[model samples]
Target: MEALEARVEALCEQGNALADLEDHAGALGRFEQALALLPEPQDSHPSTLWVCVAIGDMLFLLERYPEAREFLRRAVALPDGLGNPFIHLRLGQCAFELGDKRRAGDELARAFMGAGDEIFDGEDAKYLQFVRSILLPAQDA
Candidate 1:
C-alpha cells in the first residue's frame, strides 16, 4: 500500500466495521471523508476504487439508488473495478430499482459470470431470479 493508502485503508476499515454493524449511514460518512483525502482526479488514486465501492454500497443499502449508481459508475472507471463482482451486482441492483431492466440484466449477468451464484446468496432472491430469466432462456435455446 502507498503512504496515503494506509491512511485511507484505516478509514475504510472503520467504515467496514460500521457497515458490519448495519450503521450504513455512518459508514458512508467515513468513506466520503476518506475519498476527500485524495488529490484532484480521484480516479488516479488506487484507494479511490474501493472507497467509491464502499460509499456506493452504503448508498445502495440506504435505498439511495441514484447516488449509489453514480458512485458505483465512478468505481467502474477505476482500476480493477470492472472486474469486481460486487460492483457489478450493486450496479445491477441499482438499475433494477431504478427500473432499467436492460442494464440490470446486463450487469447482473456480469456479476453472476464473474463470481458465480454465491455472490447472490445474501442478496435478494428477486435479483437472481431476474438474471435467470434472462440467462436461462438463452441456455435453453
Candidate 2:
C-alpha cells in the first residue's frame, strides 16, 4: 500500500509538471495512470480526489467537456469534493458546454460562493456571467 501510494504521488507530480508545461494530454495520461492504480473502489483512496480532479481538469483543458464532466461528477461525490471550488468550477464549465444550463448554474454558484470570482479567472468570462445571471435573479426575487 505504501509503495502504491508513493507511485501515485510520483504520477501526480509528473502530471502537474506536464500541466504546467501546457501538455494537457500528457497530464491527463499521468493522472489516469495514478487513478488506475488505486484500489477497487477508487473513491476510498485518499488520492482519488486530486487525481480525478486533475484528470478532469486536463480533459477540460483539452476541450473534452463530456469526458471531463463525467470525471468531475464522480469526483464531486467523493470525500471533501462537494465544497471544492475547482471541482465545481470545472463541473460547471463542462455542464455549460454540454448545454445543461440549470446544472451549470448550480455548480458555478457553488464555486462562486466557495472561492469567489477568482476561480473563474483562468477561464472565460461567460461562466461568471452565467453564474451572476442565475444568482442575481434569486437574490433580487
Candidate 3:
C-alpha cells in the first residue's frame, strides 16, 4: 500500500511536470493513472482534490470548459481547509469560459478574498483587477 501511494505521488509529479511543459494529453494520462491507483474516497489515502484540480486545469487549457468546470467544482467542494485559492481561480476561469458570468464573478471574488498576500502578487493582482472591473461589472449589468 505504501509503495502504491508512493507511485501515485510520483505519477502526480510527472503529470504536473507534463502540464508545465504544455503537454496536456500526457499530463492527463498521468493524472488519470494516479487517480486510478488510489483507493475509493471512503478508504484512507491522500485526498484526490489536488489531482482533480490538476485535471481540471489541463481541461481548462484544452478549452473543454464544461468538463473543466465539473472537475474544478468537485475540487472546490472537497473538505474544508483543503481548498486552495488557485483552484478557485481556475474554476472561475472555467466558468467564465462556459458563459456562466455570475458564477465566474463569485468564484473569482472568493479567490481574491481567500488568496493570501504571498500568493496574490504582481500579475495576479492585475488579474484580480481585471476580473473585478470587467467580469463583475458585466455580470451586474
lDDT for each of the candidates?
Answer: 0.93, 0.93, 0.75
Task: Tell me the deviation in Å of residue 74 in model 1.
Answer: 0.7
Worst 10 residues of 1 by lDDT: 132-141
lDDT per residue (tens digit) for residues 1-141 in model 3: 889879989999999899889899899889888878888762234457777888887888888889888888877777642347788788777777677878877777677777743444633355466566754465533
Which prediction has the highest TM-score against the true structure? 2
Candidate 1 stretches with Cα past 4 Å from truth are 1-3, 138-141
Clashes counted in candidate 1 amount to: 0
Model 3: lDDT to the true structure: 0.75
The runs of at least 3 residues in candidate 3 whose Cα sits more than 4 Å from the true structure, single-residue gaps closed, are 42-44, 81-83, 116-130, 134-141
Deviation from native of the Cα of residue 59 in model 2, angstroms: 0.7
- What TM-score does prediction 1 earn? 0.93
Clash pairs for candidate 1: none
Better of 1 and 2 by TM-score: 2
The stretch of ten residues in a row with the least summed lDDT in candidate 2 is 132-141
TM-score of each: 0.93, 0.94, 0.80
